[model samples]
Target chain A: MGNCYTFKIKNNFPELELLCAEINEIARESNFSEQLLFSLNVCLEEMLTNIIKYGYDDNRPHDIEIRLEIDNEIMILTIIDDGHAFNPLEADAPDMKSDLQHRQLGGIGIFLTCKMADKLSYERKDNKNFLKILLAPHVAAL
Target chain B: MKLTQLESTDRITNLLLSGSLDISGVKDVEMDFARLASGKRAVVVDFSGVTFIASLGMRMLLSAAKKLDSEGGRLILHSVPPLVETALETAGLTMVLPVVKDAPDAISLSQLQR
Candidate 1:
């Protein structure tokens, strides 16, 4: 059974390094798939960036705590933020087929997060929004 | 971590990006793309040089593309290097964003009367 690990980061962008690095080290040590590690990091970045940009409405910065656990072949990532209650999963889905010139730039984070993860869910628990993403075991390319 | 202008035409802009597009490079790329979005209706981001893109990099593209879209502009991607393409494809960005064969094609397509 792989153990879970937790780390805290300020809403600032650079603080994301700590979380990514930690996740990378753990994944390497645990022999997680490379694709799994990369996807997890990307998913984390998408969620954390949203929290940093919109969670507090660009006001005073706050903190985000990230937790990761692996069971069997699945990897789970949980992100919690104490800032203003906002849910990335609730953001309106993008009109993906729209012409490039007509598309909007925002919401790509949530879009990519949901797309990359095998399983994704969110909820506001005790006034904190917990965003979770799961990655399935890597499958060889066909 | 590395970005070099691959080609620039009146209709499209292609950039060869390499290394990791993560927290370290997001801000700079955002600022760079912000400037590129100015006065341009279509942009093509060539990922031929890129190997990996994290959430931070994806956010940069999303936000930048949104800005361009709001202005009645667009961003297309081309020649996504295999390593980086995995990330984008898995993210379903390949389906959402317009992708082309190479820089010239992207530019030509961007210039098409739409």
Candidate 2:
């Protein structure tokens, strides 16, 4: 058993900065390494940004929920948004091999989130999108 | 976020960037970065001060790199911290943009492409 933390923010782009600051404080208190911290930050920012940008069709405010739980050496992150039915796992991976001339920028965020997290799962229930991510400390090569 | 434009000479413009290159950070310097990078033969960005980077920031750099590439110029980055460097590498940006050890090396790499 470990500690769990939950944070809620409005579906606004500017709110991301505040959320990131809170996460940073928590990461420091938990003694998270810089690499792990950076990975978590990237994953959260990409997911929330997508929700705020394209989740809603109406111009109304909404609440996005983020929950973090740390058990043993692994961390679990859950994000819940009352947005449209979009599954990130199904998103196409960016063509990383493509040169600059042909590369597309739109898909890199989701691609990065998929690549950085050790495990990712997505579900939609009652018009809410749920995304779960698991991260583990990197073990150096022997 | 802070962006300092070093004095340009020898056809290579140097820009020192520090702080998180997230959405707000990118908003703070994208226009200025564009202005400084425009029409330059080569640009060397010092990434030692950059603490974190997101996809939006990557887009900004990629857009600038592509612009420079189209103009027959090059963009070189150096002194990146390991975490940020990993993010760039994961995105496969090291293929398009050259990452070196230091500013001098970055400048020399950009110069050689000319």
Candidate 3:
């Protein structure tokens, strides 16, 4: 890995702002493409929002760890959360063809991330959910 | 996020939004957006100033649009960036919250509903 950035945030929405700021700073320092930066933001928001919103059973504080690696021509993102076991790769696809009245709000975040990312994988290790995303040179922006 | 009503009347409502429509940003303007967009008038939003959007943002827009449709009103978005437009299309929202080229087009489209 060329440069690795790691962060740990409490599982809350307010805590996400700080991490997003750090990612913005990293994007500035590395001069990453706008598409990639947008994708990165989307990935973090979607994945972590799921963990923070629906990852736990009891009302207790939790910590989520995020790691971003800027290798030569690819960007690697790894998120670790001590929430319940859930695989994003198996998420139901959002209803993209539905009309406004019948549209479903669920799964749009993960669906957008999947459309933007080049590759994505999920694993449960040590009672934590590990979701890794790889974005190559192409972000598949339309 | 910042949401400003450029103009508002019984016939139409025009608003300008500038900021990332993330979780916090959504919280910042969702109430005002809903209030303005829920009225019995065509709502036009200028999206050129908006730099980023995601699912939360999409939900906000769709909710307003759905409310408008139920009330016989409509919401239109104009001057969107390509990337932001991509996200909207990905969510298939351009149909209900139609995207136009500029303020004039958005205003015209909104008025067309009347």
RMSD of 3: 2.3
Instruction: Give candidate 1 regions above 4 Å deviation.
Output: A138-142, B6-14, B28-46, B54-77, B86-98, B101-114
DockQ of 3: 0.76
Ranking by TM-score: 3, 2, 1
Q: Which TM-score value belongs to model 3? A: 0.94
Q: Can you write out model 3's per-residue Cα lDDT over B1-114, one digit (the tens) per residue?
A: 999998577788889999999888999999999988886778889888898999999988998999998998888899999999998988777765689999888777776734
lDDT: worst 10-residue window of model 1 chain A: A96-105
Using TM-score as the measure, name the better of candidate 1 and candidate 2: 2
Which stretches in model 3 have alpha-carbon errors above 4 Å?
A138-142
Q: Write the per-residue lDDT of candidate 1 for residues A39-141, one digit (tens) a residue.
A: 7777877788777777786677677888888776778888888877776767887555655445444565677777678877888888888887778856322
Chain A TM-scores, per candidate, are 0.84, 0.90, 0.93
Candidates 1 and 3: which is better by TM-score? 3
Each candidate's DockQ: 0.35, 0.77, 0.76
- Each candidate: what lDDT? 0.72, 0.87, 0.87
